[model samples]
Target: MDKQELGAFLRTRRERLRPEDVGLVSGARRRTPGLRREEIAVLAHISTEYYVRLEQGRAPRPSGDVLAGISAALLLTDAESEHLHLLAGTAPIQTGLHRRDVRPSILTLLERLTQTAGFVTSATFEVLAWNDLAAALMEDFGALAPADRNLARKVFLVSDGDGRGGPLYGISDRAEFRQTVVMRLRTTMARYPSDPAVIGLVEELRSGSAEFARLWERHDVQSVPMLTKTFRHPVVGDVTVDCDSLALTDRDQHLVLYSAPQGSRDAEALALLSVLGTEGIDMVPDARR
Candidate 1:
């Protein structure tokens, strides 16, 4: 078990809960945030000392029953509960590097989506493959090396001259996208604790970006699906499109498609992107430099 991380996860979840949230009375002015440790232990039907040890990173691997009780007491969502299990070493963990190779059929599909900006991202958010439209809408992934194509890095590490994070192709949902990146990376790290690349990337982000460090400490595991997004394209102005992320479970990758309805203004913008293909505009900075 990752004792430190387990303790941290439990602590964060517990601290985010209020007494009223778990049906407990606020007997007095609480000193700390959320529900107290004693209350959590009481709700979980475990000893206060043991729960304290668990939160202190001094407890043994908790039994499934104990974990279930704690999960219920904390009122974790399904994703959060699964993350708790993963941190406590109670769930099945993927035991190797995350796959980067895209399925050939997926590559074919990207090519076939004539008007849509389609791309496939690895579990770590590396842009593995993309169509011409994707290259046009975003940056040209083909021009960069494998390491430079990670969306997480682009979102968190890359910044404008003022040191704030750069706009994600000037997407309207930049804030939500940052949250999604942290949530997904948290899940990825738990699943691939031993993978050097995963570990290094997370560490780099945490060290490089203060915003990333702040968000990482929250221990959030759930991500809301984004249905639509708008990008302030330098060439096409504002183009909004529907967002769809299809999981390629076999490879642990995602086929992300951005498209608009037929004959819509957004569709016309995408069509123009298909023809332009990063010709005159630099949507992204050169990562190689």
Candidate 2:
């Protein structure tokens, strides 16, 4: 949102990196703070004048390829690269819809994995579909609002003060999990800038959560395929699950599969969850699902 701050931050980051950091060499008598403008230009495959113009915020909007070059040249973090995309108004294409209506396939897959819990979520964090085991493992997902459904939103935007939502169901280490999710979201946004759903989600988070705003300013990006999560289930008690995220490239969605070590207490709890469905329970209402 702050274009001048964005440009300044990027320039400062570039000035803090040495030529050697980006696989460049600087001979003796190099008195500059970091790599010279010409050095960065060469590394980024751009003219020195153009690079200078970019630093000065005088150049025209850059293409994605050019931004990638600059990102590499400056060693920008995933969040930073995403921030760059936002600043340049060329964020990645994040498709918000799961048009395949693959609920049946998802249910079948979940049925096959009786010992594990799994669910399918769209790029914008819509819980398109989930198996019974998944529903049992995480009770809140079954009670999500169709419009504002997402784990990240629940963690960050939910306010306990207002009796809405909060990190009531997530792990105690909520900050780290929030950062991880936001970073992943940044990566998604970078790849799908035009997705109105993603854009709207970002807007909502920015308005609703100061922590999200702070993290978003950092421009971090992360795409880890796996994560270890601990949840404090209201009914089943505390359980630890290793979550694996598989990107369904064919469908432009992702499958978040949860598993626990066999023979562990958590595993037993998950096993019990497999037998239960959304019955004989009052689903918590989440206005911003």
Candidate 3:
């Protein structure tokens, strides 16, 4: 195991974080940028001396539980999390190969959802196929370059007018949205370490958006909830709909359907969006940012 590299990596990860990131009160007089070793130790339930040994490259290899605690404390990304295992000489975590191809039946399902805003995405969140309602509601994925048909990159890099990007699907609760996207991307990274699409997207986002970089470092992971989401469209106004994700079994592709209940204002907005078609619709602009 590369003990020295592990120590250095851990130290660097720690230094990049601020106290407020982990719920600690920031002291004005502190000299360094991140949490102290003692604070990390306390958070990890380890002794200060043990953690110091870890940083000094003298400590024995850490167990899985110990690594998990450390990972949580430092907020390592999926890549960072796996790298920690290799450096620690432990068994690698299994983020098995993710399926990228969309099944025929899934495509049929997407097409059948005429009243709903529907689309299919690869494991890496690449926009594979989207309907007219989706295009009208959000940006036109079909018009985007195949390489640019990525959700994470659009969320983090694309701008409406200024350098900063516009709101995602006009969702106002941005923090929650960012967290959800980042978490899912991390899971995908773990599952497909060698995927050029996922890796390139990661590199692009890290270089482009400081916010994405910070969120990526946090290493959040979870299932995207089957919850109702609100979208504030420029033409149709506001529409709230339930977002449902259906996995295409072994194919690993996802069919995402957005639907509002009948007779609801959101349903009306969706209808208006369909009628509006491609008019008053613009997607992630320039992308030079």
Candidate 4:
């Protein structure tokens, strides 16, 4: 690690902000350029002494995990975060838009899942592709801006369902769903530490949502397992489905499929949803007349 350069970089970034920028209070007579070393250490979940040693170029090189904590604490941009990793002798994050190409085979498979809610997403949870059933079951991914098509953005940026455009879980497992999504998201961010899209989404969420920031600070990381969620559809009432993910071996992408138990109300709802989609697809073109 370039300990001396790293020290200087940290000091400068820390000094550029005000106490209120990180939800800290400024008392009278308090004087620190941006945030004190102690405050940064606290935010990064590290020892004040250790952080001080690092800033003074007295500490050993930090691992990627330690750098990640510091990156989040400083609210570094994607480019800046990657620079931190490079200075610490860790691998830099990929500094560009997330790869969004879903394999043609995957698209065909998605189309064949008539009774399932199926969509394709990037490693960072950006919705790259989706089928009609998925569009019917959850929020419409196609309608959202390319950036807002991201699952993390939808979950964190949107408030509760009470708000006009807030996210609506429409199910009883809202907390579990959120916990799993956040855990998987943290894991994805680490896996692709330098991706500008992931870092941008995280920074945006951290700034706009205190709940997200709090959860993010905990540093929970995990894989998203096959689980079930219930969706309350306005036209079809409630539907419960098993959520499964199929990772595309060629790239950092996955196909998510949601299926309901046979003979169940959810299964019936899927059937109804398919019928609706079919009718829409079968409509005659206005210009053809």
Q: Highest TM-score: which candidate?
A: 1
**Of candidates 2 and 1, the better by lDDT:** 1
How do the residues 61-167 of candidate 2 rate in per-residue lDDT, one tens digit apiece?
88889989988888887767777777677764434543435556666786788788787877666677777777776664656677645777777877877533376
Each candidate's root-mean-square deviation in Å?
2.2, 5.4, 6.0, 9.6
lDDT of each: 0.90, 0.71, 0.75, 0.73
Error of 1 at 135 (Å): 0.6
Task: Estimate TM-scores for all models.
Answer: 0.95, 0.73, 0.66, 0.63
Give the winner by lDDT: 3 or 4.
3
Write one digit per residue (lDDT tens) for candidate 4, span 1-289: 6677578778877887688989998767766578999999999999999999999999998877788999989988775686667667687444455578888888998899888889988877788999988887665566679777776666666666453223544665655656666656665565555677677777887788677777666544433464887776666667888988887845778888999889987898898877675343234243101
Off by over 4 Å in 2: 1-39, 61-72, 76-104, 161-165, 223-226, 276-289
Ranking by TM-score: 1, 2, 3, 4
- lDDT by residue for model 1 over 111-212, one digit each (tens)? 899988999998899999999999888877888998889989988898876676877787888889999999999999999999999999999999999999
Compare candidates 2 and 3 on TM-score and give the better one.
2
Ranking by lDDT: 1, 3, 4, 2
* Candidate 3: residue 15 Cα off by (Å): 13
Task: Put down candidate 3 lDDT per residue, 1-289, tens digits, no spaces.
Answer: 5567567767877888899999999978998878899989988888899889998999999988998899888887765777677667685533555666677776777777779999888777778888888888877777779778777767787776756654566676666667777766765665556677677887888898888888777644543474778877766677888888876656657788889999988898888878877675643343222
- Candidate 3: residue pairs that collide: 159-165
